[model samples]
Target chain A: MNAIGLVAFALVGSAKAIRAEFDLFGVTVVGLVTAFAGGATRDVLVGRVPLALQNVGEVALGLLGVCLAVVLYAWLEAPDDRPITLYADAIGLAAFATAGAIVAIEIGLPAFGVVAIATINAVGGGAFADLLLDRSPFILFEDFYASCAVLGGSAYWLFTALAADATLAAAACATVTVGTRVLALSRGWTVPTAQRLEAVTGE
Target chain B: MNAIGLVAFALVGSAKAIRAEFDLFGVTVVGLVTAFAGGATRDVLVGRVPLALQNVGEVALGLLGVCLAVVLYAWLEAPDDRPITLYADAIGLAAFATAGAIVAIEIGLPAFGVVAIATINAVGGGAFADLLLDRSPFILFEDFYASCAVLGGSAYWLFTALAADATLAAAACATVTVGTRVLALSRGWTVPTAQRLEAVTGE
Candidate 1:
């Protein structure tokens, strides 16, 4: 939970629109939302009655994410904030993607469903929070966010097939997700624009 | 869905504030938010992946609720819109409460957990939307909104204990909830307030 909290704090920090001039409160709120909201959302969707309700540790993790965001932000006060936010976001994405997949698998979802659920669970809260905050989702704008998640899940899927093991799948998937995200951002590599943009926004 | 939509529509039509100046788009957006946001929120909280992704019907119901609000506003054009908003709030509370409890029960949560989830699922979204929209949640101020949901889940719990005996529990619970809400409003009965007021305006 502590590890995940740190990752989630970074993810939410990255997703915020730095131009929005958010205070510490707003930053903490975003972190809380992105980290807890996804798992909480998963619980509601699965009708598990919110694991957080039963698990004090999960609740503590959420609070931890908010605290970390504030502390981390203060520590990284600089001319360039992007580097700090990017690394944080990457950590969050990897942790959540792996966590989501594992949860799904444990709950007896099929592999496809597990992968899909994991991908969404990892990204959904941050995406929704960013939307609510009136910021374009980092995934939809610049970063190859979804692609990396997909790749991570695919790696997990492949590793699990090879070994018929959950631990290896999760570790491999998370590592792939983080490394791929870093590479994508550093190289400015992207999935080709299959979506028709000129046709989307008419003048 | 149609019945709920009709109720939602009538609630909107009955609001004088909305009819006075707000456009069709604004009214519809409010209605949609009022009707669907609760259920969407419930789904998000429960980790109900399929519910979120596959329940296209819920979206349709939301659209219906929005349309109902639009038509109702255009036709009734009522005065003192307070009652209308109250009714809409009630429906949102009831519908979301029902969904939350049912999902909790379906997922095999214990009675205590179901009740808690139902209560939160019922009110959380409205509270959030209100917070986002910069308004107070109705549950905190008027009507037996949260209480009704808790009672309703209790009924469901009791019913299950009675071995699915289609007895008075379910109906009684529903009646208690709805009746308490309407009665509280009709009589202007409020939670006791002794020294509730603060020194500052809006305090």
Candidate 2:
């Protein structure tokens, strides 16, 4: 699960860097950051050394994703906005969110902490990458992306509270997160902004 | 030291949010994040709950800074570029960097980790605030800001290596960091970028 998340996020991040016309070094840095940052942040919040630093295999997997992205971009000329990357990103998000939720629960965090950490673990890398690209984080204002993690985290908490099996709870969490993200992607779903709310109210 | 750093960073962050035309809630969020994020990050790296969350006084100090910023902005109409704010920011940077270095040493981190965590603790908040404001972090591509922390951290390690007293080492770290920052601000020193280097080399 960790490997999948690392590779997918690295690919997604490298694609963004490529689209932004960054140099090769910049692309690799951004990809590595995207792949490791979310999990690193989760580990930090839980008071542990980031797993990326401890495990050489994790870095290798992230680098593999970066290489794949560079090759794919070279072949396709522009793969960032394509469906393949989007689907990979969705899967990565679910994997990370579920992983974070399990960790938070294992560490005996409160429900709010669990959900918050899960969401952060899911979207933190994309947010960091967006910052590197000199833009507002899409999770903050523009996308329906993070909401899926929030909902999935809530579901995980609910299942745990109801004494569900750990594996069952994990599966439900990932399924809900990925399902919602894919549906949102296909249906153009977006969270309403303050401006949209004001317009709706005619105020 | 934490109190001073928290208040100063909060004021600086709130001022930035106001200049960006964020609403009151946005300003508050930015202010709190800028004040707390660095310290929180430092604590997390060293394996502890953030002091801000653990202590009510810390939150109050940060809020005081936010309120002060809002009031000052309303009165002066444009105080973001004022010298007072710059000096306060420098102090905050030094205080946070010294604090982080001390923690890293206490935790027996290597020299690299000490320097890295110190720099992150000093500038993490500003970087985060910049992200929320939809801009690339100033630390990444501009300013002589983070380098001051790096130098300070190195100095701290050197002092400790020479078997200096912990208090003296911390004082030296803070002094070096703030001294360099103030000098740089007055002299208009900036770290050169790739473009500048290329231009200089006539490449």
Candidate 3:
């Protein structure tokens, strides 16, 4: 399988893990949504009817992801099951962000629009997915995760302007993005907050 | 508020009622997605950015819907305590489908594209919304629901061409849509099934 395919499989697995509380039907639904949610967002932002529904591979793969998730959850049976949800969500965001920006820039979007499209593509599905599942993944409390995605997308757009070193820049962008996410996870560094001294907090 | 605002708020409340198990954030997400999912979809399909973010009112109203839903759910808990999810999902779908058709046809889409776009605008969000929340909504299981949305949208499109009366046709479309949905719910009717009976019977 290609990189995208591998990542998609991981997504299905993670979806199952996340939806362990749900029934089988519910698990299937979660798997499909998590697997295709980002892709659907990317396609919509780029004015391309969703490609996930256009092919059987994606659906089959998503089901497979559900199965894997079920098995993995059964085996793990603990909340500390590594970074299944986090990694899958992050990778899905990055892949879709790349796809969104490329499609936007390809269709002659301006710089700012490209950035906005990329950001939406990256976070839109995950946020919606989390909300539906009664959680708020990255946006609710994850610091700087969304920022990394936007930065990566912007970097990808910038690389388009390069004449010879475009691929190199794209690689750099991916590394920077994935690295930031991993660092945030490993170092326990969150997006900074501004919940400073409140007016209600008296001396 | 305008008619659209009223419809939007009602749809948002309905969405929350349908997705009853969701949290406050989840309710807001579902409400906003249900309320704006149609028009947002129309804009994206026609290569226009979603207007939800452009107009601050839409967001405020959507949040208001969430608040309304929170209050309604609380009140219902104290009184009727009936499962109104099916009803709310239906209302949301009906409104989105009709409005989506209008948006698509107005954008000069051909008959088929308009029908497809309108139907997606109507059913996509609701279906996926339910799927995300692990709810096997009747529309997915009971059947005849999405098909009616398509039919209503198509009727509206056809009527617009023959009568040149936008309001009349839109009303007709909405009527057919709601009627079909309501009858289906009341009578427990469904569309055709193509499953393998032999396999089920072990023939």
Question: TM-scores of the first chain across all predictions?
Answer: 0.75, 0.94, 0.77
- Per-residue lDDT tens digits for candidate 1, residues A149-185, read 7788777777766866898898898899889989988
After best superposition, candidate 2 residue B122: deviation in angstroms?
Answer: 10
Kindly report which residue stretches of model 1 are placed more than 4 angstroms away from their true locations once superposed: A1-7, A10-30, A41-47, A67-82, A107-111, A134-136, A195-203, B1-203
Off by over 4 Å in 2: B1-32, B51-127, B136-203
Worst 10-residue lDDT window for candidate 3 chain A reads: A1-10
Note the Cα lDDT for every prediction shown: 0.59, 0.83, 0.61
- Rank all candidate structures by their TM-score, best first, as comma-separated numbers: 2, 1, 3
**Model 2 Cα lDDT, one tens digit per residue, B11-32:** 8888887776565545666788
Error of 2 at A200 (Å): 2.7
Error of 1 at A149 (Å): 1.4
Q: Residue A83 in candidate 3 has what lDDT?
A: 70
User: What share of the reference contacts survives in each candidate?
Assistant: 0.13, 0.24, 0.07
TM-score for candidate 2: 0.62
Interface RMSD of 2: 5.2
Score candidate 1 by DockQ: 0.10
Give candidate 2's error at residue B1 in angstroms: 16
Better of 2 and 3 by lDDT: 2
Supply every candidate's count of residue pairs whose N, Cα or C atoms clash at under 3 angstroms: 18, 0, 2
Question: What would you estimate as the lDDT of candidate 3?
Answer: 0.61
Best by TM-score: 2
Model 3 DockQ reads 0.09
lDDT of 2 at A72: 94
